[model samples]
Target: MTSTVYAPHDHHTCITAALANAKTLCESRGARLTPVRRRVLELVWQNHKPTGAYELLPQLAQDGFNSAPPTVYRALDFLLELGLIHRISSLNAFIGCAHPGQEHTTGFFICRLCGNALELSPERMQDVNTRLAEELGIVIEEQTIELSGLCPSCQLAATTAKEDIA
Candidate 1:
Protein backbone atom coordinates (compact mmCIF):
# COMPACT_ATOMS: atom_id res chain seq x y z
CA MET A 1 0.00 0.00 0.00
CA THR A 2 1.19 3.49 -0.86
CA SER A 3 1.63 5.93 2.00
CA THR A 4 -0.29 9.13 1.74
CA VAL A 5 1.26 12.39 2.84
CA TYR A 6 -0.73 13.61 5.82
CA ALA A 7 -1.79 17.10 6.74
CA PRO A 8 0.29 18.68 9.46
CA HIS A 9 -1.29 17.91 12.82
CA ASP A 10 -1.54 20.46 15.60
CA HIS A 11 1.95 20.95 16.97
CA HIS A 12 0.74 21.97 20.39
CA THR A 13 -1.46 18.91 20.61
CA CYS A 14 1.32 16.71 19.31
CA ILE A 15 3.76 17.81 21.99
CA THR A 16 1.13 17.64 24.69
CA ALA A 17 0.08 14.14 23.70
CA ALA A 18 3.64 12.94 23.44
CA LEU A 19 4.57 14.41 26.79
CA ALA A 20 1.49 12.94 28.41
CA ASN A 21 2.22 9.52 26.99
CA ALA A 22 5.84 9.69 28.04
CA LYS A 23 4.90 10.78 31.54
CA THR A 24 2.46 7.90 31.92
CA LEU A 25 5.02 5.40 30.67
CA CYS A 26 7.68 6.82 32.96
CA GLU A 27 5.42 6.68 35.99
CA SER A 28 4.54 3.10 35.21
CA ARG A 29 8.24 2.22 35.02
CA GLY A 30 9.42 4.41 37.94
CA ALA A 31 11.33 6.62 35.50
CA ARG A 32 11.39 10.39 35.66
CA LEU A 33 11.16 12.67 32.65
CA THR A 34 13.00 15.75 33.83
CA PRO A 35 12.37 19.32 32.67
CA VAL A 36 15.51 19.78 30.59
CA ARG A 37 15.05 16.43 28.94
CA ARG A 38 11.43 17.27 28.24
CA ARG A 39 12.43 20.56 26.65
CA VAL A 40 14.97 18.83 24.44
CA LEU A 41 12.34 16.35 23.33
CA GLU A 42 10.00 19.23 22.65
CA LEU A 43 12.59 20.89 20.43
CA VAL A 44 13.28 17.71 18.53
CA TRP A 45 9.58 17.26 17.85
CA GLN A 46 9.12 21.01 17.23
CA ASN A 47 9.70 20.15 13.63
CA HIS A 48 8.49 16.97 11.95
CA LYS A 49 11.87 16.44 10.27
CA PRO A 50 14.89 14.83 11.80
CA THR A 51 16.97 17.21 13.95
CA GLY A 52 20.72 17.13 14.47
CA ALA A 53 22.14 17.63 17.97
CA TYR A 54 24.09 20.69 16.86
CA GLU A 55 20.94 22.23 15.48
CA LEU A 56 19.14 21.60 18.76
CA LEU A 57 21.92 23.01 20.96
CA PRO A 58 21.35 26.64 19.98
CA GLN A 59 17.62 26.28 20.40
CA LEU A 60 18.08 24.77 23.81
CA ALA A 61 20.37 27.60 24.85
CA GLN A 62 17.91 30.13 23.52
CA ASP A 63 15.34 28.62 25.81
CA GLY A 64 17.62 29.25 28.84
CA PHE A 65 18.92 25.69 28.86
CA ASN A 66 22.60 24.74 28.60
CA SER A 67 23.98 24.72 25.09
CA ALA A 68 26.65 22.11 25.76
CA PRO A 69 26.87 19.13 23.44
CA PRO A 70 26.94 16.66 26.31
CA THR A 71 23.78 18.12 27.77
CA VAL A 72 21.94 17.51 24.53
CA TYR A 73 23.50 14.09 24.10
CA ARG A 74 22.51 13.06 27.60
CA ALA A 75 18.99 14.24 27.08
CA LEU A 76 18.84 12.40 23.76
CA ASP A 77 20.12 9.25 25.44
CA PHE A 78 17.45 9.43 28.11
CA LEU A 79 14.74 9.91 25.51
CA LEU A 80 16.05 6.99 23.49
CA GLU A 81 15.96 4.83 26.59
CA LEU A 82 12.33 5.76 27.01
CA GLY A 83 11.63 4.98 23.32
CA LEU A 84 10.52 8.55 22.72
CA ILE A 85 12.98 9.16 19.91
CA HIS A 86 15.30 7.35 17.51
CA ARG A 87 18.55 8.32 15.87
CA ILE A 88 18.79 8.37 12.11
CA SER A 89 22.22 6.81 11.63
CA SER A 90 22.48 7.84 7.98
CA LEU A 91 21.89 11.52 8.87
CA ASN A 92 23.51 11.50 12.31
CA ALA A 93 20.34 13.22 13.44
CA PHE A 94 17.33 12.31 15.55
CA ILE A 95 13.62 11.96 14.81
CA GLY A 96 10.76 11.43 17.26
CA CYS A 97 9.24 7.96 17.29
CA ALA A 98 5.79 7.87 15.73
CA HIS A 99 4.33 5.38 18.18
CA PRO A 100 4.96 6.22 21.82
CA GLY A 101 2.93 3.83 23.97
CA GLN A 102 4.28 0.46 22.86
CA GLU A 103 7.78 -0.82 22.15
CA HIS A 104 8.16 -1.23 18.42
CA THR A 105 10.70 -0.89 15.62
CA THR A 106 10.44 2.03 13.21
CA GLY A 107 11.30 2.56 9.54
CA PHE A 108 11.83 5.90 7.86
CA PHE A 109 11.02 7.03 4.37
CA ILE A 110 13.19 10.08 3.87
CA CYS A 111 12.58 12.36 0.94
CA ARG A 112 15.78 13.34 -0.80
CA LEU A 113 14.10 16.24 -2.55
CA CYS A 114 12.27 17.70 0.44
CA GLY A 115 14.02 16.13 3.44
CA ASN A 116 10.64 15.21 4.89
CA ALA A 117 10.77 12.00 6.95
CA LEU A 118 7.95 9.49 7.27
CA GLU A 119 7.95 7.19 10.30
CA LEU A 120 6.50 3.70 9.83
CA SER A 121 5.40 1.27 12.53
CA PRO A 122 6.78 -2.22 13.21
CA GLU A 123 3.91 -3.88 11.36
CA ARG A 124 4.90 -2.02 8.20
CA MET A 125 8.52 -3.01 8.77
CA GLN A 126 7.98 -6.77 9.30
CA ASP A 127 8.67 -7.70 5.68
CA VAL A 128 12.10 -6.07 5.79
CA ASN A 129 13.14 -8.14 8.80
CA THR A 130 11.72 -11.35 7.34
CA ARG A 131 13.62 -10.85 4.10
CA LEU A 132 16.85 -9.86 5.84
CA ALA A 133 16.74 -12.83 8.18
CA GLU A 134 15.98 -15.29 5.37
CA GLU A 135 18.50 -13.89 2.88
CA LEU A 136 21.39 -13.14 5.24
CA GLY A 137 20.91 -15.62 8.09
CA ILE A 138 21.08 -12.68 10.44
CA VAL A 139 18.79 -12.13 13.39
CA ILE A 140 18.20 -8.42 13.68
CA GLU A 141 17.98 -6.79 17.07
CA GLU A 142 17.56 -3.06 16.39
CA GLN A 143 17.00 -1.20 13.14
CA THR A 144 16.63 2.34 11.86
CA ILE A 145 15.96 1.67 8.19
CA GLU A 146 15.61 4.79 6.03
CA LEU A 147 14.62 4.80 2.36
CA SER A 148 15.51 8.05 0.60
CA GLY A 149 13.76 9.34 -2.50
CA LEU A 150 11.59 12.12 -3.84
CA CYS A 151 8.37 12.72 -1.86
CA PRO A 152 4.95 13.11 -3.40
CA SER A 153 5.14 16.90 -3.52
CA CYS A 154 8.34 16.92 -5.53
CA GLN A 155 7.06 14.17 -7.82
CA LEU A 156 3.94 16.20 -8.51
CA ALA A 157 5.98 19.32 -9.22
CA ALA A 158 8.20 17.42 -11.68
CA THR A 159 5.17 16.00 -13.45
CA THR A 160 3.54 19.44 -13.74
CA ALA A 161 6.73 20.99 -15.12
CA LYS A 162 7.02 18.30 -17.79
CA GLU A 163 3.40 18.79 -18.80
CA ASP A 164 3.80 22.57 -19.03
CA ILE A 165 6.85 22.25 -21.24
CA ALA A 166 5.01 19.83 -23.55
Candidate 2:
Protein backbone atom coordinates (compact mmCIF):
# COMPACT_ATOMS: atom_id res chain seq x y z
CA MET A 1 0.00 0.00 0.00
CA THR A 2 1.06 3.56 -0.60
CA SER A 3 2.24 5.51 2.43
CA THR A 4 0.54 8.72 3.46
CA VAL A 5 3.80 9.87 4.96
CA TYR A 6 4.88 11.29 1.64
CA ALA A 7 1.53 13.02 1.33
CA PRO A 8 0.02 15.89 3.29
CA HIS A 9 -2.48 14.78 5.94
CA ASP A 10 -3.41 15.10 9.60
CA HIS A 11 -0.39 13.42 11.22
CA HIS A 12 -1.64 13.97 14.76
CA THR A 13 -4.08 11.10 14.33
CA CYS A 14 -1.20 8.75 13.53
CA ILE A 15 0.59 9.54 16.77
CA THR A 16 -2.61 9.43 18.79
CA ALA A 17 -3.64 6.00 17.52
CA ALA A 18 -0.12 4.67 18.01
CA LEU A 19 -0.06 5.76 21.63
CA ALA A 20 -3.50 4.30 22.30
CA ASN A 21 -2.52 1.04 20.65
CA ALA A 22 0.62 0.87 22.75
CA LYS A 23 -1.47 1.30 25.88
CA THR A 24 -3.83 -1.51 24.97
CA LEU A 25 -1.01 -3.80 23.86
CA CYS A 26 0.83 -3.24 27.11
CA GLU A 27 -2.29 -3.93 29.13
CA SER A 28 -2.91 -7.16 27.29
CA ARG A 29 0.65 -8.33 27.84
CA GLY A 30 0.70 -7.35 31.53
CA ALA A 31 3.39 -4.83 30.73
CA ARG A 32 3.63 -1.20 31.62
CA LEU A 33 3.88 1.52 29.00
CA THR A 34 6.07 3.66 31.19
CA PRO A 35 6.64 7.32 30.49
CA VAL A 36 9.99 6.70 28.89
CA ARG A 37 8.59 3.97 26.69
CA ARG A 38 5.59 6.04 25.72
CA ARG A 39 7.80 8.97 24.94
CA VAL A 40 10.08 6.84 22.86
CA LEU A 41 7.10 5.54 20.93
CA GLU A 42 5.91 9.12 20.52
CA LEU A 43 9.25 10.12 19.15
CA VAL A 44 9.19 7.26 16.70
CA TRP A 45 5.72 8.21 15.52
CA GLN A 46 6.41 11.94 15.48
CA ASN A 47 7.03 11.49 11.78
CA HIS A 48 7.43 8.75 9.20
CA LYS A 49 11.18 9.20 9.33
CA PRO A 50 13.23 6.38 10.70
CA THR A 51 14.81 7.69 13.92
CA GLY A 52 18.14 6.56 15.22
CA ALA A 53 18.72 5.95 18.93
CA TYR A 54 21.24 8.77 19.02
CA GLU A 55 18.81 11.16 17.37
CA LEU A 56 16.29 10.53 20.13
CA LEU A 57 18.71 11.28 23.00
CA PRO A 58 18.66 15.06 22.89
CA GLN A 59 14.92 15.14 22.47
CA LEU A 60 14.43 12.84 25.43
CA ALA A 61 16.80 14.90 27.51
CA GLN A 62 15.09 18.09 26.46
CA ASP A 63 11.82 16.55 27.60
CA GLY A 64 13.40 15.76 31.00
CA PHE A 65 13.46 12.04 30.44
CA ASN A 66 16.55 9.94 31.06
CA SER A 67 18.73 10.34 28.00
CA ALA A 68 21.22 7.66 28.78
CA PRO A 69 22.00 5.28 25.93
CA PRO A 70 21.04 2.29 28.05
CA THR A 71 17.70 3.84 28.97
CA VAL A 72 16.90 4.65 25.36
CA TYR A 73 18.01 1.24 24.16
CA ARG A 74 15.87 -0.46 26.76
CA ALA A 75 12.83 1.53 25.74
CA LEU A 76 13.47 0.72 22.08
CA ASP A 77 13.84 -2.95 22.88
CA PHE A 78 10.59 -2.97 24.82
CA LEU A 79 8.76 -1.32 21.95
CA LEU A 80 10.27 -3.80 19.52
CA GLU A 81 9.29 -6.70 21.74
CA LEU A 82 5.69 -5.57 21.83
CA GLY A 83 5.72 -4.97 18.06
CA LEU A 84 4.87 -1.33 18.67
CA ILE A 85 7.92 -0.42 16.58
CA HIS A 86 10.36 -1.99 14.14
CA ARG A 87 14.08 -1.64 13.75
CA ILE A 88 15.25 -0.79 10.26
CA SER A 89 18.41 -2.86 10.32
CA SER A 90 19.89 -1.24 7.24
CA LEU A 91 19.62 2.23 8.72
CA ASN A 92 19.89 1.16 12.34
CA ALA A 93 16.84 3.28 13.04
CA PHE A 94 13.32 2.69 14.35
CA ILE A 95 9.87 3.50 13.03
CA GLY A 96 6.43 2.88 14.51
CA CYS A 97 4.58 -0.11 13.05
CA ALA A 98 1.43 0.74 11.09
CA HIS A 99 -0.34 -2.46 12.06
CA PRO A 100 0.75 -3.89 15.34
CA GLY A 101 -0.96 -6.04 18.04
CA GLN A 102 -0.38 -9.49 16.61
CA GLU A 103 2.07 -11.66 14.76
CA HIS A 104 2.21 -10.88 11.07
CA THR A 105 4.57 -10.90 8.14
CA THR A 106 5.61 -7.45 6.97
CA GLY A 107 7.94 -5.61 4.67
CA PHE A 108 9.42 -2.15 5.27
CA PHE A 109 10.01 0.33 2.50
CA ILE A 110 12.56 3.03 3.16
CA CYS A 111 12.87 5.97 0.84
CA ARG A 112 16.53 6.13 -0.08
CA LEU A 113 16.37 9.79 -1.03
CA CYS A 114 14.36 11.15 1.91
CA GLY A 115 15.01 8.61 4.68
CA ASN A 116 11.30 8.16 5.36
CA ALA A 117 9.91 4.69 6.03
CA LEU A 118 6.61 2.84 5.76
CA GLU A 119 5.31 -0.56 6.77
CA LEU A 120 3.78 -2.63 3.99
CA SER A 121 0.71 -4.71 4.81
CA PRO A 122 1.01 -8.21 6.20
CA GLU A 123 -1.34 -9.61 3.60
CA ARG A 124 1.00 -8.47 0.87
CA MET A 125 4.02 -9.89 2.60
CA GLN A 126 2.16 -13.10 3.42
CA ASP A 127 1.24 -13.64 -0.20
CA VAL A 128 4.86 -13.43 -1.23
CA ASN A 129 5.99 -15.70 1.57
CA THR A 130 3.33 -18.31 0.86
CA ARG A 131 3.97 -18.31 -2.84
CA LEU A 132 7.72 -18.69 -2.40
CA ALA A 133 7.43 -21.43 0.21
CA GLU A 134 4.87 -23.41 -1.71
CA GLU A 135 6.87 -23.20 -4.88
CA LEU A 136 10.33 -23.80 -3.37
CA GLY A 137 9.51 -26.20 -0.53
CA ILE A 138 11.88 -24.39 1.80
CA VAL A 139 11.38 -23.63 5.50
CA ILE A 140 10.91 -19.98 6.27
CA GLU A 141 12.66 -19.64 9.53
CA GLU A 142 13.76 -15.99 9.48
CA GLN A 143 13.59 -13.12 7.05
CA THR A 144 13.77 -9.39 6.80
CA ILE A 145 12.26 -7.60 3.80
CA GLU A 146 13.79 -4.16 3.57
CA LEU A 147 13.33 -2.46 0.21
CA SER A 148 15.23 0.73 -0.45
CA GLY A 149 14.20 3.11 -3.24
CA LEU A 150 12.88 6.56 -3.94
CA CYS A 151 9.32 7.10 -2.65
CA PRO A 152 6.54 8.57 -4.74
CA SER A 153 7.10 12.14 -3.69
CA CYS A 154 10.80 11.92 -4.22
CA GLN A 155 10.28 10.36 -7.60
CA LEU A 156 8.07 13.25 -8.59
CA ALA A 157 10.61 15.76 -7.34
CA ALA A 158 13.42 14.08 -9.26
CA THR A 159 11.38 14.01 -12.44
CA THR A 160 10.40 17.66 -12.09
CA ALA A 161 14.01 18.70 -11.60
CA LYS A 162 15.08 16.86 -14.74
CA GLU A 163 12.25 18.35 -16.76
CA ASP A 164 13.03 21.89 -15.59
CA ILE A 165 16.71 21.53 -16.53
CA ALA A 166 15.77 20.20 -19.98
Candidate 3:
Protein backbone atom coordinates (compact mmCIF):
# COMPACT_ATOMS: atom_id res chain seq x y z
CA MET A 1 0.00 0.00 0.00
CA THR A 2 3.06 2.19 0.43
CA SER A 3 5.67 3.24 -2.12
CA THR A 4 9.12 2.57 -0.71
CA VAL A 5 11.28 2.50 -3.81
CA TYR A 6 12.35 6.14 -3.57
CA ALA A 7 12.72 6.09 0.16
CA PRO A 8 15.63 4.77 2.15
CA HIS A 9 14.64 1.49 3.80
CA ASP A 10 15.76 -2.06 4.46
CA HIS A 11 15.78 -3.97 1.17
CA HIS A 12 16.07 -7.37 2.79
CA THR A 13 13.19 -6.63 5.16
CA CYS A 14 10.98 -5.60 2.27
CA ILE A 15 11.71 -8.76 0.32
CA THR A 16 11.31 -10.97 3.35
CA ALA A 17 8.00 -9.40 4.30
CA ALA A 18 6.70 -9.69 0.75
CA LEU A 19 7.61 -13.38 0.52
CA ALA A 20 6.02 -14.07 3.85
CA ASN A 21 2.85 -12.22 2.93
CA ALA A 22 2.71 -14.06 -0.40
CA LYS A 23 3.05 -17.42 1.30
CA THR A 24 0.23 -16.61 3.69
CA LEU A 25 -2.03 -15.29 0.94
CA CYS A 26 -1.45 -18.35 -1.25
CA GLU A 27 -2.16 -20.73 1.57
CA SER A 28 -5.31 -18.88 2.57
CA ARG A 29 -6.56 -18.81 -1.00
CA GLY A 30 -5.94 -22.51 -1.52
CA ALA A 31 -3.25 -21.78 -4.07
CA ARG A 32 0.00 -23.70 -4.19
CA LEU A 33 3.17 -21.62 -4.26
CA THR A 34 5.36 -24.12 -6.06
CA PRO A 35 9.15 -24.00 -5.98
CA VAL A 36 9.46 -22.41 -9.40
CA ARG A 37 6.79 -19.89 -8.67
CA ARG A 38 8.38 -18.99 -5.35
CA ARG A 39 11.77 -18.62 -6.94
CA VAL A 40 10.39 -16.42 -9.69
CA LEU A 41 8.82 -14.19 -7.08
CA GLU A 42 12.11 -13.93 -5.25
CA LEU A 43 13.88 -13.00 -8.44
CA VAL A 44 11.27 -10.39 -9.20
CA TRP A 45 11.77 -8.88 -5.75
CA GLN A 46 15.56 -8.79 -6.11
CA ASN A 47 15.20 -5.07 -6.64
CA HIS A 48 12.53 -2.44 -7.00
CA LYS A 49 13.13 -2.36 -10.76
CA PRO A 50 10.97 -4.15 -13.26
CA THR A 51 12.33 -7.34 -14.80
CA GLY A 52 11.40 -8.81 -18.16
CA ALA A 53 10.60 -12.47 -18.63
CA TYR A 54 13.59 -13.04 -20.90
CA GLU A 55 15.86 -11.48 -18.29
CA LEU A 56 14.58 -13.91 -15.69
CA LEU A 57 14.93 -16.95 -17.93
CA PRO A 58 18.72 -16.92 -17.89
CA GLN A 59 18.77 -16.36 -14.15
CA LEU A 60 16.49 -19.30 -13.65
CA ALA A 61 18.67 -21.43 -15.89
CA GLN A 62 21.77 -20.50 -13.94
CA ASP A 63 19.92 -21.39 -10.77
CA GLY A 64 19.36 -24.97 -12.03
CA PHE A 65 15.78 -24.56 -13.19
CA ASN A 66 14.50 -25.86 -16.51
CA SER A 67 14.57 -22.33 -17.95
CA ALA A 68 12.20 -23.11 -20.79
CA PRO A 69 9.96 -20.33 -22.01
CA PRO A 70 6.82 -22.26 -21.23
CA THR A 71 8.00 -23.08 -17.73
CA VAL A 72 8.78 -19.48 -16.93
CA TYR A 73 5.63 -18.24 -18.60
CA ARG A 74 3.50 -20.57 -16.53
CA ALA A 75 5.05 -19.32 -13.32
CA LEU A 76 4.53 -15.73 -14.39
CA ASP A 77 0.94 -16.50 -15.29
CA PHE A 78 0.33 -17.95 -11.87
CA LEU A 79 1.87 -14.93 -10.19
CA LEU A 80 -0.16 -12.53 -12.30
CA GLU A 81 -3.36 -14.46 -11.68
CA LEU A 82 -2.72 -14.32 -7.98
CA GLY A 83 -2.06 -10.58 -8.12
CA LEU A 84 1.35 -11.23 -6.61
CA ILE A 85 3.03 -9.37 -9.49
CA HIS A 86 2.17 -6.71 -12.06
CA ARG A 87 3.37 -6.25 -15.64
CA ILE A 88 4.38 -2.81 -16.84
CA SER A 89 2.94 -2.44 -20.33
CA SER A 90 5.52 0.06 -21.51
CA LEU A 91 8.55 -1.91 -20.31
CA ASN A 92 7.12 -5.42 -20.79
CA ALA A 93 8.56 -6.14 -17.38
CA PHE A 94 7.16 -7.39 -14.08
CA ILE A 95 7.37 -5.98 -10.53
CA GLY A 96 6.15 -7.36 -7.25
CA CYS A 97 2.87 -5.89 -6.01
CA ALA A 98 3.33 -4.14 -2.70
CA HIS A 99 -0.24 -4.78 -1.74
CA PRO A 100 -1.79 -8.10 -2.67
CA GLY A 101 -4.98 -9.94 -1.67
CA GLN A 102 -6.90 -6.72 -2.06
CA GLU A 103 -8.81 -5.21 -4.94
CA HIS A 104 -7.16 -1.96 -5.93
CA THR A 105 -5.87 0.01 -8.87
CA THR A 106 -2.07 0.21 -9.18
CA GLY A 107 0.03 2.94 -10.73
CA PHE A 108 3.76 2.81 -11.43
CA PHE A 109 6.23 5.67 -11.20
CA ILE A 110 9.20 4.38 -13.21
CA CYS A 111 12.55 6.13 -12.98
CA ARG A 112 13.86 6.61 -16.49
CA LEU A 113 17.49 6.65 -15.35
CA CYS A 114 17.79 3.88 -12.77
CA GLY A 115 14.85 1.74 -13.89
CA ASN A 116 13.48 1.78 -10.37
CA ALA A 117 9.68 1.50 -10.13
CA LEU A 118 7.46 2.71 -7.33
CA GLU A 119 3.90 1.55 -6.86
CA LEU A 120 1.44 4.33 -6.28
CA SER A 121 -1.40 3.77 -3.87
CA PRO A 122 -4.69 2.71 -5.41
CA GLU A 123 -6.51 5.77 -4.09
CA ARG A 124 -4.19 7.95 -6.11
CA MET A 125 -5.37 6.26 -9.32
CA GLN A 126 -9.03 6.01 -8.40
CA ASP A 127 -9.53 9.71 -9.10
CA VAL A 128 -8.33 9.31 -12.68
CA ASN A 129 -10.42 6.21 -13.24
CA THR A 130 -13.48 7.99 -11.94
CA ARG A 131 -12.97 10.93 -14.26
CA LEU A 132 -12.37 8.73 -17.28
CA ALA A 133 -15.40 6.62 -16.53
CA GLU A 134 -17.57 9.70 -16.24
CA GLU A 135 -16.25 11.26 -19.42
CA LEU A 136 -15.86 8.16 -21.61
CA GLY A 137 -18.59 6.02 -20.05
CA ILE A 138 -16.28 3.02 -20.22
CA VAL A 139 -15.57 0.51 -17.51
CA ILE A 140 -11.96 -0.19 -16.74
CA GLU A 141 -11.56 -3.89 -16.04
CA GLU A 142 -7.79 -4.03 -15.85
CA GLN A 143 -5.59 -1.10 -14.94
CA THR A 144 -1.83 -0.57 -15.00
CA ILE A 145 -0.98 3.10 -15.12
CA GLU A 146 2.69 3.80 -15.76
CA LEU A 147 4.31 7.23 -15.60
CA SER A 148 7.97 7.61 -16.55
CA GLY A 149 10.05 10.14 -14.61
CA LEU A 150 13.18 10.45 -12.52
CA CYS A 151 12.99 9.30 -8.92
CA PRO A 152 14.00 11.62 -6.04
CA SER A 153 17.62 10.51 -5.96
CA CYS A 154 17.98 10.77 -9.72
CA GLN A 155 16.38 14.20 -9.67
CA LEU A 156 18.77 15.37 -6.99
CA ALA A 157 21.78 14.06 -8.91
CA ALA A 158 20.64 15.82 -12.06
CA THR A 159 20.19 19.06 -10.16
CA THR A 160 23.62 18.70 -8.52
CA ALA A 161 25.25 18.16 -11.91
CA LYS A 162 23.58 21.30 -13.27
CA GLU A 163 24.70 23.32 -10.25
CA ASP A 164 28.32 22.16 -10.67
CA ILE A 165 28.23 23.09 -14.34
CA ALA A 166 26.89 26.56 -13.50
Return the TM-score for each candidate structure. 0.86, 0.95, 0.93
Candidate 1 C-alpha lDDT tens digits along 106-146: 78888887777778758868877889899999999877688
For all candidates in order, the CA lDDT equals 0.80, 0.90, 0.89
What's model 1's lDDT at 135? 100
Best of the two (2, 3) by lDDT: 2
Candidate 3 error regions (>4 Å): 135-138
Clashing pairs in 2: none
Q: Write the per-residue lDDT of candidate 2 for residues 11-71, one digit (tens) a residue.
A: 9989999999999999999999999999999999989999999999999999999899999
Better of 1 and 3 by TM-score: 3
The deviation in Å at residue 149 for candidate 1 is 0.9
Model 2 regions lying over 4 Å from their true place: 1-3
Q: Best candidate per TM-score, number?
A: 2
lDDT of 3 by residue, 39-86 (tens): 999999999999999989999999999899999999999999988999
Residue 92 CA displacement from its true place in model 3, Å: 0.5
Can you give the lDDT of residue 59 in candidate 3?
A: 92
